[model samples]
Target: QMATETRTHGDYTVGWICASSIERRAAMAMLDELHEPLPTPEYDRNIYTLGSIGKHNVVIACPPMGTAAPYIISMTNIFRAINFSLLVGVGSGIPPDVRLGDVVVGTLEGHNPKEMMLNPLVEAENSVHVETWAATPPQPLLEALKKIKTEYELSGSRIPEYLERLKRDSPALASRYLKSDSLQDLLFDADYGHVTPDFANLSFIPREENDCRFCDKTMTVKRKPREMRVHYGLIASADREIKSAPLRDRLCRNFGGKVLCIDMDIARIKILFPSHYPCLVVRGICDYADSHKNMEWRDHAAIMAAAYAKDLLHEQDLQILEWLTPVDYGPRHRDFLRRWQPETGLWLLDSAEYKTWLSTKKQTLFCPGDIGSGKTILTSAVINDVKTRFQINPVVGIAYIYCDHRHKETQQIDELIASILKQLTQKLFSLPDCIRQMYEKHKYGQTRPSLNEILGVLHTIIGEYSRVFIIVDALDECPTSSGCRQTFLKELSNLQNQFGVNCFATSRLDPDIIAQFRTNSISLEIRENAKDVQLYVKRYMEQLPAFTELDQWQQETMLVKVLEHVDKRYDLA
Candidate 1:
């Protein structure tokens, strides 16, 4: 009974998801036999069209218009029952070579699937795979495409016959396609856009017919042969429409000229499918994805995409479903200090000695104080000051680490080094070749670097930047079980002494830790800056209504008492 149920659910061989109603209708028109709409669960909002195309049982679906999240949810729920998926839709073309009616088929490239599965805009330990999350079409689909191209070359294209069949089934779709004008398929130079005061305004307003102000023939680019063609390359998928030619060109170039078109929804679906579940995008070229996008060719483009999908599906044999188990790269961890770093409240910013050290050639500056002397706050202020001073210099990189006793697992020496390295590489926007090579070597396996291996990567990364500022706060809190603290300090000393990386660290004055920095480091005592504490205390107390209600003499007495208690604590340390 279980085997029969599994076989019934696995009968769906192809899944088709479209972005618009026109694309969905075009896809439905290609079906050989149609069935009644299958009942779905309440949570499943997708309106699925069940049918057979050629010898394959295909499921066609579309989400509510103008959103992508529901499409993702719908596809994921249906993907388990199907063997393969196709994101068939209309996308904007990157112009000059790609024309208005051209079809773009996405090809796969190697990508870190773990990074692509997560939201790219959110913060994560590993960098997001923004431009590299595409995979080539599977081997079977590529062979079918080649056969289709060869057939089209031998005989006339099948698109005309497909259009006739579609006309008989739904005249409305055929009428829309017939009304699509080829004269509106004009390619303009990248530098010339709609003549507006600012090109950033994206709202579309109704205009009278023949009122286009920027339709000068001088700005139009003429193509030699305006024939429809199939282009195989990277098809970028994003949640929003790309509207600038400069940005489109930049993305195309960044993807190494393999990106031929841009779509609103496809890449996200591709990344979430099972690794063995073959997927491809068949999209018609609607517009140039620039500022001048109009709805002149959308219907015609959708028809072209559906026609191409039918040609690819016709006469294909049923495939046996073989599930390939995907490799799981573990979750990426982040060492984020910006949210937890101490506030810079009336301290460190006014320190003349620290300012002098920052402006000069000092390689290391140590701020030692008792546990409650606001060392973390001081370190945070120094970080802010350095960032402000170096705001204009693109070559300077700044990173900080805050050690906590509560999180014992992260306090190890290797974790500390990895956190620091992650911060620096993220800030610099490019990793050193040495670190990249090391990562590539260990990427396939679960083996992480030893302490020595991490140190070697750090040493090489430090040489790539002109200057790097690293701040380590609460070093005394680092675990001391296996000489972790000593090893961490020794590595810092080496970075300062050998590589000239400017290191700023704050800790309680332990003789062992201080001794490590005594020879080449400049130490500043927080107790010496009593004025900063006084100012901080006064400002903090002024905000309290009860303290404000006290008499002047009472305020002074309370202030003195607070300072004396703090001083005694420092003495104990």
Candidate 2:
């Protein structure tokens, strides 16, 4: 005991409560060697040592073996009651990959049954339906373990949790090392060897060292300084042990590309906090399931891993890496508002049109009126609102697309046709049935369309149920070939009869354009000369402080005159 006491230790003591008396004694001996004591209490069979790690103090306790479920439940239930960081699991390892002397770290868990059984977070383009599962590891902690493993030799073990069990109630649940290939043969009929669907399917990305914003190019990395370093990686927590290729293949593929480590319970952890918490999985590879298996790395692996964790905690470089604490894992819950990346053409939209879009789902109805009217802006606003407002089965996007004609004048019937068709081809991902049928029948780009030919094409493209609103401004500014203006009128008439989409256009009120849609359409001419002139005058006067642009009496006179002019003609909205 005196020799043990002479061994210097951290201010805190650590040990598993499920560890037997002999294991506990070794734990105490280690603590004594480090100048720490095993104050982990013996309550029931659970072990907890009371001590200090830095300024914070708590009993580092362990529940029954393979008992993280109970241990975590109890730990969290009293999380407000305890001062420790977490309930870290310590267990056996599969030899060589995780030999008797090697130290290993357990960070993540895979609870497969819960994931495969639940139909959550399913949407288009994972491209197909794949089984789901939960993955967990607090990322920061898992990353710390990885850096530690690199400088020090480590070992891994499957069912190290079972080792905890052998210490307690059952000797039947084997804690011995077993290769993944031989894992099934070893535990074929062994007690509690059932495979629990693992939380292996979730998409987990690890923290990269050099995260640069300017490029998607791979980063060159180097270590920086920090304190309390945490390790992260892929973590799997399965109920029944998994040793098959299908399961291994899925995990191997994800981990091969992902910052792979192991952890347990992201889904449950996500549920634990309704807010956004990125999933991090880090686990010790317990066995060399691959052809090259080693059998000497187990016991010391965890200890070595723990040493790295300690080194990181004390290292001067800890603070430099603090920025890794926050990562933007876009909305995990479907009910929450989704954010759109700029590249996806979904930037942001907040407008009245957004409100109308959600409540009515109305696609057509252009913001009619002349130039400077907020038509496109209003459309963008509506699409943005749709992103936030509809929580369940959310609308993909409110597409705000515009066509800039090369002609630069008014929208011609042919130019308009060309622009609309181009937008459809460029933007819409799927070809509608009518469009597909029409394309199969006609050869495209043979030549530009005549006015009547354009109308025939428009009818096929814009079908019923889903209406695409066309906003064409300045019809009067449009230059036409000869007297095609009359023919343009005929095309407009055909659009309404066949497609039934509402058309919103602005123009100089040419007698021909007006007369064309004169039937079965709504039109009102804007007296731009009236409101714009008054607005310009009012805005100029308001720019001066204390009505200083003009005398207070003069301001009153001007304000009244502007109000009268504004209220007299035209509608705004």
Candidate 3:
């Protein structure tokens, strides 16, 4: 049974890019739950399937043009929240190591940085129009790749199991997606050309049969039957298909014999998208890049790649909720993060002061803004950015607090300090001895630890990590009536001064809060940028009841008028 949920565009985190309907269908089959389609912009020509594979909300898109243009349009229009992308499909395999139906993930074997780039193929004195270099994929995906590969080494592949499940669920596609017989999986020698039997007569122009039935079976190369497996190495991609064996060999030689598979059109992604757009290519070998290639294994190959991707996502899902702590700000953090507009608040990330704060130890950054200045949303962006950057590093800890006046009673100084300890300990396998001892010391008496005791335990936990980031949003909301705010700020300063912890805080221009950081911290005033203001106004206008009734000019005029009013009042610069 397929469960359907209503989700917004920002909810999706993974972009599964496909070139053909077969690959699209393969991607859809792997979804655990299908989400209701959200409205897209008129300019985006690509169609998307929104669904979830494990914990990941994956947006699978098949471009109309099968090029980079449509994919870029779609990203700009609909996939604003996509963290990274995966290019999944079937491709022609490089021989000697890879066989038909085996999966190839685009990653270097070891630490060789040279494999990061693939030189363009020169055929007939012309260079192929494709991306010459590719950036590294996101760290989480790389970590998942390592985990899945380790699992494969220990227990073989789970791809066969997923394929069997798909066959059981979709009867119509079962026949097409079924594995081809080993006998039909044929490879011809590179020098052996598929030519007409009547070679003596020039009248014979081409081979007749699509299959190799009419060709000389004796020319087929013999290979031992092996289980379908996954390979990891460099992938060579081009603008066009490689149907010629000599061209494929030349391309492989150009890459120093490191090309594991050759795929068409994937290069467009790297060529068009920036390096920050993280992507990983996963290809299933459909045929050896030779004249004997046919559609016999393409369907099987597509499903094989899709099955591996699903398993990879399943592994990724496991890592997300592997730990639970007593106090978790994850819910609050997620709520604030959901309000973030894509591509907004990037100026703060690019600012020199913010960079210095991140690069230096024991640094504090204070951001003060007026009310309705999108301070909370920008803070959420910073938290999300920092977490994404250091997600794969076990020695880094991120703890955040979303202070609210309504919850001030529960968000006292001791509780707030302990929350940091709670979050950081979740990153470790077990609690530090001091924390466990403190808990035991107070458990029987139902007594709460003092602020200093909690801070002492926090100090112990902070030492476990190479670096720790403390982010507090809406710090002005921390209750000042009972001295909670002052105590909390003092504890944060003590941690930064004593333990080299990095602290990031956002509050209104409260004189007391500003006084604490004015001397020793990098301070930045949070102001709404013109672009972000325009985006916010446009999104709000789109939700109005009369928005659709207006013509294009009128709608644009309304947007311009609203932005002008905002600029006049706030001086968005």
Candidate 4:
């Protein structure tokens, strides 16, 4: 039997799904006040407890215990009715460094359920299947977790206060399960096991009054406060308990040593929910999932997880989804930039012409250089400088493309335009109306825009910004045989002519590319500095072991030869 009245989806944006009664109770304890339970249909067996936490209507539920199937069913229905902005709950943890009540936040590497699964053949051979689920939580939730972690580290007493409050609320449960002293939190070697004696022999009976005496406290490992603090990494999720220490270590190693903890339920939630749904898993370490299982840390761990969740929800605006759709282009640009240090292009930064180009509008700078004359580094330096110069201006936008022959796909014209658009929109913090409309039209179908469509979008986005600067490096690396290189350069020229956009480009003196920009663009040839080259050759000759053993005349001859070769190469370029 179920109540006739149903709970409206608009009333609640956060859905907290707990695996056990203790976890559900822990979540409820964090709420400010409880609301009336809405009616559920007979077919829907979930028991929903509606509540409010800091102006947010939260619905908490605990599916039937002991199996994952019922929990999946409950979550499926819950998500269908409520578009949860936050989906999280307490889960079991299995990391040696993670203490009994410490929290572990999931990173991007930890959200792959497919990689965590055991192959059918391996499962058949072992007579068991390991469950590993991983999904990256939303960006906002991750940011909130980072803030809460900082506060916890600084205060050092929040967990104790939260425990005290829980004790006052439920005295009996606290006494039974949360009464262990800090010294009781011990770590045993993975190979160690509880001793089992022969029951058939009467001599095996213990003489002392204490419970079986096989446990050794001296074998425990010691840890510092920082070691027990909150951790952020990949979390392995599965339905069955991982009790073998060797297996746990193997899984951790197999996952590239990034798995900070293991959980039971997060994988199912990720597998069932839509990919766009915003969710985060915040779990406390209840057990090590080894031979040392106990009820002492269960209540305290649940409380800590719920307390952290409450802190995360506080003062957070639940209505905004600004951070939900993350842009991928930023990371790609950053990865390329990280290889070179800040001063790699110091020579280019010191140039007076480059300074003039930075302040000029509707100007095109074609920086032509030799293959190894450090053009790419100069382009990166120019991009960094432009970003710093216009960081405070909302009307200015900066975009860049680093072309490499090693990666052919990145040189595609559509990819180039898409990358530029992504950078501009990310800087603006919102997409232009035209780009948003195009995205909406194709997002559901997983269809990418054609080159012409992307060019139209880029044109619209450029018009939105008062001044836009585009830097394209290594134009010679783009596949000229496919005509993509020519087409892309033509678009840049068009942008400068039509929208008055400034273009900074680098190439290896390609005849076709030079012809396109030579008329109106400023051409700068990157030549090697003779004095710097001589200094480098001298340093190299001094460092060589053989040259150090040689006479002064021999060392001088080697330096002269190196300088002559460098001069010849520069002249050929």
Each candidate structure's TM-score, on Cα atoms with residue i matched to residue i, is 0.47, 0.28, 0.53, 0.47
- The sequence of per-residue lDDT tens digits that candidate 4 reaches over residues 450-484 is 88887887788787788999988888898776788
Candidate 4 stretches greater than 4 Å from native: 1-9, 65-81, 85-95, 109-133, 136-139, 153-158, 176-179, 196-213, 224-228, 315-573
lDDT of 3: 0.77
Off by over 4 Å in 2: 1-412, 424-457, 512-514, 528-533, 541-573
Each model's lDDT: 0.65, 0.35, 0.77, 0.64
lDDT of 2 at 508: 49
User: Highest TM-score, which number?
Assistant: 3
Residue-level lDDT for 103 in candidate 4: 77
From the highest lDDT down, the ranking of the candidates is: 3, 1, 4, 2
What tens-digit string does per-residue lDDT give for candidate 1 at 274-390? Answer: 445466788899889776777777778887888788777762421110001011111110112232233333445556767666765536788788767667655656666786686
Report the CA-based lDDT of candidate 2 relative to the real structure: 0.35
Count clashing residue pairs in model 3. Answer: 0
Quote the positional error of residue 322 for candidate 4 in Å.
18
What overall lDDT, based on C-alpha atoms, would model 4 receive against the true structure?
0.64
What does candidate 3's lDDT look like per residue over 1-573, in tens digits? 455556788888888888888899888887877888888878777878888876678899888866644565566557688888888999889988999989998876653433233233344544454323445788998899998898688546557656665676787887778774543777888878765345423454342235566678788889998888899887776776667677778777767787788887556665566656688889988999887787778888988999888888776643422321245577676777777776778889999999999999999999999887888888889998998787546678889999998987668877788778777865553335576577668767867777778777778889988899999999999988778899889888888888899999999999988998889999999976777777767876788989878999999988887776664222222
